[model samples]
Target: MPAATSTAEAAGPTAERAPHTGPIRWIVVGSLLTGLLLAAVLSLVVFAGAPEHVITGSALLGFAAGWALLAVLSAWMTSQPQRWAWVPTAGLAATGLGLLVVAPGDGGLTAAGWVWPPALLTMAVWIGVRIRRALAAGSGRWLLYPVVVVIAASAVGGAVETVGLASDDPGRAMPGEVYDVGSYRLHLNCTGSGGPTVVLFNGLGLTSANWARVVPGVARSARVCAYDRAGQGWSEDAPQPRDGNQAAADLHALLQRAGEEGPYVLVGHSIGGDHAMIYAARYPEQVAGMVLLDATDPYRVGGGPPSAMAVLPSLARLGVGRLPPTSYWSTLPEPAAGQVRMFNANPRGWRNVRDEIATLPALLTQARDLTTLGDMPLVVLTAAGAEDDPARLAGQERMAALSTNSSHRPADAGHGALLDEERGAASSVQAVQDVVQAVRAGTPLL
Candidate 1:
C-alpha cells in the first residue's frame, strides 16, 4: 500500500508538469525570436542610409522605446494568440474611421500613404495566429520566425523614413508686399508706372509669381499688379466658405488700401477670367478694359465644379493637407518654378484651392448674371486648340460678344501662354501688350 501511494504521487507530478512546461517554452521561444528580429531590424535601420539628422540620441531612444513596446506586445500575442486576434483588426478599423472623420486635404488617402498601416496590422495578426498555431502544434515553429524578421525590418524602415521626412524642411521665401485686408494678409506685387493699372489675376491655385512669364513684358508697357489671393500662395488664411464675391470685395479693398487708383485694365486667366468679369460688372467705373485668357465660360463651366461634400471641418481637425513640395518647376522658369513648389507645399494653399473648386459653380452662375461690358475694350484670347472643340470655340465667340468693341484673338498657343518663355518669348505676353497699347491709345480693339 505504501509503494502504491508513492507511485501515484510521482504520476500526479508528471501529469501537471507537461501543461506548465508548454507555456514557459512558448514564452521563451517567442521572446527569443522577437529579440533577434528586433536586433536585425535595428541593424538595418542604422545602416540603411538613415538621415544624419535623425541619428541623434533622442531618436535612438525613441526607436528603442518603440521597439521594446512592440516586442512586449508581440510576446503577449504569442500567448493565446487567437484570443486577441481581433485587436489589431480592430485597430485597423479604427484608423480607417479616424481618417474618414478627419477628411484630408486631397479628400482621401493618396496612393503612397494608404498601404502601410493596414498592411502592417494584417501582417501582425497573421504572425500572431501562425505563432499560436505553431506552438500548439509543436511543429513548423521555426518557419514562422522569418515572417517576424521581415515584418520587423519593414516596420523599422518605414518608421525611420517617416522620421527623416518630418525632420527635413523645404524653405520658401516670401517676396511680395503684404496687405492686411481686414481678416488676413494678401501678398501683392506691383510694378511699372501709369494710369489704367494692369491688374493681373491668375487661375485657381496660381500665385502672383505665376505672372513671371507675362509680368516683365506687361510691366514694360503699363503699371501692372499681381497678387496672391487670400489663403493662397503667401497669403494668410481667412474665414471659411471662400468664394469669388468675397475675393472680389477683398481685391477692391486691397487696391483702395494700397492707394492704387483704378480705371484699371483687368487681365484674368481661367477662373480669374470669371473674377475679372465680376469685378468689371460690380465696379464698372473703375475698370477701363478687360482681357480674358482661355477663360472659363460663364454659361456652363466646362467641367462642373467639384462637389462641396468634402468634410472641410475635418481638415482643421486632422491636419491633413501637408504634402511634399511638388516638382512642377520644370515647366516654369527658375525662380517661378521654385515659388510654385513652395506654394504647393503650404497646407493653406490646398485648403483655399479646394474651397475655390467647391465654390466655382456658384461663381459661374453669378458671372452669367453680370451686365454686358458695353463698349469696354475686351480681348478674348482662345487657345489654338479651341478650334478643335466646337463648343469651346462657340463659348469664346460668345465671350467676345459681351462688348461691342471686343475682339476674338486666337493665339497659336496653348493654355498658360502668359508665362514668359526663354526662347521666342510668350505669345500671351504679346497679346496682353497689344491690348494695353490699344487701350492706352484709345484705338479700336479690332
Candidate 2:
C-alpha cells in the first residue's frame, strides 16, 4: 500500500508539469510587450537628444532587453520555456554594444550593412522555426507571430536597401561636373548661355534634381546653374553643423573652382531663400537679382521634434524611409526623378537632413543679418494661402521691403508646388525671367 502511494505521488508531479495553459502564458507575453514599451519610453525621453549612434545603439539594446525578458520569464515561470529567445538577446546585445563602442559614422554603417542583413535573416528564420517547435498551437503562439514578422520584414528591407546603396554610383550618373569645394565635392549642372548667371538654390533637404520642372524653362532665356549642397545628392558628405554660413562659403568656393562666374541671379525656394539671403548678405556684390519662391521666413523659429530627429537616421538605415512608394517623386521627370528617389533613400542624405535641421535655428538667425539688398531686382513669390496667416504675410512683406525695387507676387500654388508643378513652375520661371530682364535693362520689375 505504501509503494502504491509513492507511485501515485510521482505521477501527480508529472501531470502538473504539463505545458502552461493558464494565466502564466499571458504573463510571459506581457513581459515582452512591457519590455518594448519601456524601451520606447526611454528612447523618446532619455536618449532623444543623444547622438545618432548612441540613440541607435540604445534602441538595439532596448530590443535585446525585450528578448532577454522573454527568455528569463518564460524559462522561470512557464512550463514551455522559450530558450531560443536567448539567441536574439545575445545577438542584439552584442551588436548594440559594438555600435556604442565603435561609434561608426555613415561609411562604417554602410559597410556593416553588407554583413548584418544576411545574419539577421538567418537568425529570424531560426527563431521562427524554434518558436513553432516549442510553443503549443494556440493564442500564445499566435501572439508571438507579430514579433517574428517585424524582424523578418526588417531583414528583407535592409537587404533591399543594401543592394540599392551598392548599385547607386552618383559619380558615374551625375549629369554635370563635380567640383572640389575645399573640404568636399559639389555637383554643378549648368545649361543655356547668358550673363548674370541664374543659380538655383534648393530648399531644405532637397537636391538639385527637385528643380527639374523650373530649370529647363529658366535655362532657355539665361544660363542656369543648379548644384547640390554639401552632403546632398551627388555632393560628397561634409563635416556636420552645416549652417547657412558654411553653405554660403561652400557655394562661393564651388563657383570659384568651377569658373562659373556669377553676379548670379539667385532663384531660391523655401529654405533656399534663407541660403540666398545669407549669400547676398555676405557678398552683395556677387548677386545681380533674386527670386524668393514661397521662401521660408528667416525669423521663424522651431522645427521637427528633437526625438524624431534623433531616431530618423537609424530608421532610414533600416530602410524604413523607402517603404513609401516612388510616387512621391513622380512629379519630377525621368533620370532626375530616379536620381531624386535614389539619393532620398540613401541613409547619408537623411543624416544630412538631420544635421541641417539641427542647425536651422542658427541658420535662420544668421539670415536676419541681411537688412537690405539696395536696388537689386528682388521678386518675392508668396504661396496662395499666405493671406490666411497674418504672420506669414507680414514676413513676406518684410522680405519684399529688403529691396526698394522688389515686387511681392502671390502665386496660385502651395509652397513646394511653386517649383514642383507645371503651373507653379511657370510662375517661378516668369519671375526669374522678369528679374533677368530687369537686371539686364537696369529697370524695375513691371
Candidate 3:
C-alpha cells in the first residue's frame, strides 16, 4: 500500500498536465486551419465567378455539395481546424470532376467577373467566429486587429479586380478561311491589306476564337492572323506526331494552302510559343519576328495536364486523363462530373481542355527540339504569378531567362495578359507594333 501510494503521487502531475494540454493543442490546430481555410476561400472568390462558357445546374449542384461538405467538416471537428480546411478543398476536387464530364463547354460560374468580395465576406465570417474563440485563448489575442483589417481589405480589393476583368466592349474575331496542312487543318483569321503577316498560335485548350478579345488593335496596320492549331477548335488533328520540325513543316503546308505570304510575324502563347520558336528557327525566310506570351518552354516543363495527368501518377492511372470534363450542366457520370469544374475554373483559361489533353504526347516532342531563334526578332511577355506557386513562378522565370538569352523583352504581365481585362493586352499590341515597324523599315527586330 505504501509503494502504490508513492507511485500514484509521482504520476499525479503528468496526468494533470495532459488534460490542460488539450486546449493548447486545439488552439494550434485551429489557428493553422483558420489560415488555410481563409486562403482557400479567397482563391475561390477569384475563381468561382470567372468568364467561363459552362454554367450548368449540375455544376452548381456539385459546387454546393462541395461547399456543404466543407462546412460540415469545419463544424464537425470540435478542435482540429485542419479537418475543416480539407473539406472545401476535397469537395472542390469532386465538383471539378463533375464539371469536366459535361459537354458544351459548361464549366464554372461567370455570372459576375471578379474573385474577392464574396470570398472575403465568407472568410470574414469564418474568421470572426474563429477569432472570438481564439481570443479567449491567450495565444492569438494580439493578432485580432490585423486579422480584421485583412478581411476588410480582401473584400474591397476583390471587388476592384472584378470590375477590372469586365468590359463594356464585346470583341469579335475577324473573318478568314481554313488552311489544310497535310494531316490536319487550321482556321486562319487575318487583317490588313498587305504587310508581314502576324501569325497568332493559340495555346493549349485555346483556339482562334479567343483572339477576338485582342486582335482588333493590331489589325489596322499589319496583316495580323490568328489560327486554331491542328486538333483544336475547328481544326482537324494530324496523324503525324506533333514535333517542332513537324509543326514547322505543317505550318509551311498551311501557308501554301492558305496563299499567305512569306516573312510572317509569329506570336504564340504557352505550348504554341514552343512551336513558334521552332518554326522561326526551321524556316527563317518565312518568318519575320516572334512574340511569346507567358509561353511554356516544353523543354523545361511537361506538356498537357501537368496536374491530374502528369504530376499525380496514381490519379492518372485511375484515368483522370480519360475522364470526360465536368462543365456547367454536363451529362457526366460519378467521378468525371467532378473534374470539369476545375478545368473550367482556370484563369489562363481553356474551352476544350480534354481534347487538348489527347494531343499532349505529340506536343511533348514538339516542345523539345525548339531553341536558338538566331537572328529572328523576338519579344517575350513574362507572366506575374503568386510567390507560393513554384511551378507557375518557375515557369515564368524560365521563360524570362529564355527571352533574355534570346535578346528580347522579358517583361512581366498577367498570365492571360493578352486577354487581360485592362492593361494586359497593351503589352502585346506594343510588341506587335514594334515587330511591324522593324519589319517594314527593313531593320533588325532584335
Candidate 4:
C-alpha cells in the first residue's frame, strides 16, 4: 500500500501539467475575429466618403481574403530561420518599385501604406508563437538567441520604412518646411526672436517634427530651433553617429550653417536627452542650459552590454518583426506594423527609425558620462504615471547632480505628457521658459 501511494504521488505532478486545450484554441480564434473586425472598421473610416460603389461590401470581402492569405503565408514561412532574410529583401524590392513607379496619390495605393498591416500582424504573432513554443520545449539556449535576433532586425527595418514614407510624402510637411532634420539636411526652424538659442533634440525613431507642438509657444519668447537627426525623418544619413557628441556637433554646425545665433540651450527627449548630456560635456561654452525629458540611462539602460541580438542589428533583420505580446516592454500599445512586414516590401517609414536607434546603446552610455556642460543649469523631467520604478527616477537624479554645478532635483513633468494633457504640456513649456529666463538673467539655473 505504501509503495502504491508513493507511486501515485510521483505521477501527480505530471498529471497536473497538461497540454493547452480548447480554451487556448478559442482564445486564438477570438483574437483573429477581433483583428478581422478591427480591419473592417478601419477600412470603413478610410473609405467613408468615397463613392459608395467604390467601397462596396465586395471590397471588404476582398480585404478579408487578402488578410487571410497573408496570415497563412506569414505563419508558414516565419517558422524557418533562413526565410527571415527574404522578408526584408522582398520589402526593399517592393519599396523600390513603389518609389519608382507608384507615388502616394490622393487615395490610391502608395508605396508607404500599401504593403504593411497585414504583413506585420501575420509575422509578429507567428514569430511570437514560435518563441513561446521553443521556450515550452526547452529549446537550446544558442538557438533561442538567434531567433530573437531575427525578430529585432525586422522591427527596426519596419520602423525606418514607416518614417521614411511619411517624411517623403509632400502633403505631410509643415507649410514653411519640407525637410525633416534627422537626416543631415540641417533643416533648422529658428524662432524670429534674437535671444539666446534653444536647440532641441529628438529621441530614437522620431524626427524634429515631433517638437512641433512645443516650438510655437517657445518661439514667442526666444529663438528655438528643432531639426531631425541623421537617418531620421527627412534628414540625411550620418557620416559619423547620431550619438551624443555627434549630435552636439551637428547642432553647432547647423547654427553656423543656418546662420543662426547661439550660446544655445539644449532640450532633449528620451535618447535626445542623452545627446544633450554629451553636447554639454563636449562644448560647455556653447550650451546655456539643458532639460532632459525621460532620457535613457547609459549605465542601466542599453548603454551597458546588450544581448547578442542588440549587438548585431543585421541579425534582427532576420527575425519576423514581432514585438513583445503586451505593452510591457515598449511604450506603444500597438506594435509598429513595419516590424513584421517583409523589410523591402513594407511601404511604412518606421523600419528605418528602429534600425538606427538600436545601434546607439553603447554610444548613449558614453554620452551620459560627458559632464563638461556642468556649469550650465539642468532640469530633468520624468513621467509621473509611468511604471513605478524607483531605479529610473533615482538614476536621473544621480546623473543630474553629477552634471550640475550645484543642486539636483526633478522637474514637475511627465514623459511625453507635455503634448497630451493640458497641465502636463503647460508644465513642460513653463519649465523651458524658466530655463530661458535663468539663462537670460545670467543666473545659475542648475
Model 2, span 332-424: residue lDDT tens: 767777778787776776777777777788878988999999989999999999999999999999999999999999999988888778898
lDDT of 4 by residue, 345-380 (tens): 222223344344545775567676675455566676
On TM-score, the stronger of 2 and 3 is 2
lDDT value, residue 436 of candidate 2: 96
| Residue 427 shift from truth in candidate 2, angstroms | 0.6
Error (Å) of candidate 2 at residue 182 is 2.0
Model 2 error, position 150 (Å): 1.0
TM-score of 4: 0.53
RMSD list, candidates in order:
12.1, 2.9, 13.8, 15.9
Looking at candidate 4, what is the lDDT of residue 89? Answer: 36
Task: List the candidates ranked by lDDT, beginning with the highest.
Answer: 2, 1, 3, 4
lDDT of 1: 0.63
Which numbered prediction scores highest in TM-score against the true structure?
Answer: 2
Tell me the deviation in Å of residue 160 in model 2: 0.7
Please tell me which model should have the higher lDDT, number 1 or number 2.
2
RMSD of 3: 13.8
How does each model score on TM-score?
0.65, 0.93, 0.48, 0.53
> How should the candidates be ordered by TM-score, best one leading?
2, 1, 4, 3
**Whose lDDT is greatest here?**
2
Cα lDDT for residue 305, candidate 2: 44
Model 4 lDDT-worst window of ten: 332-341
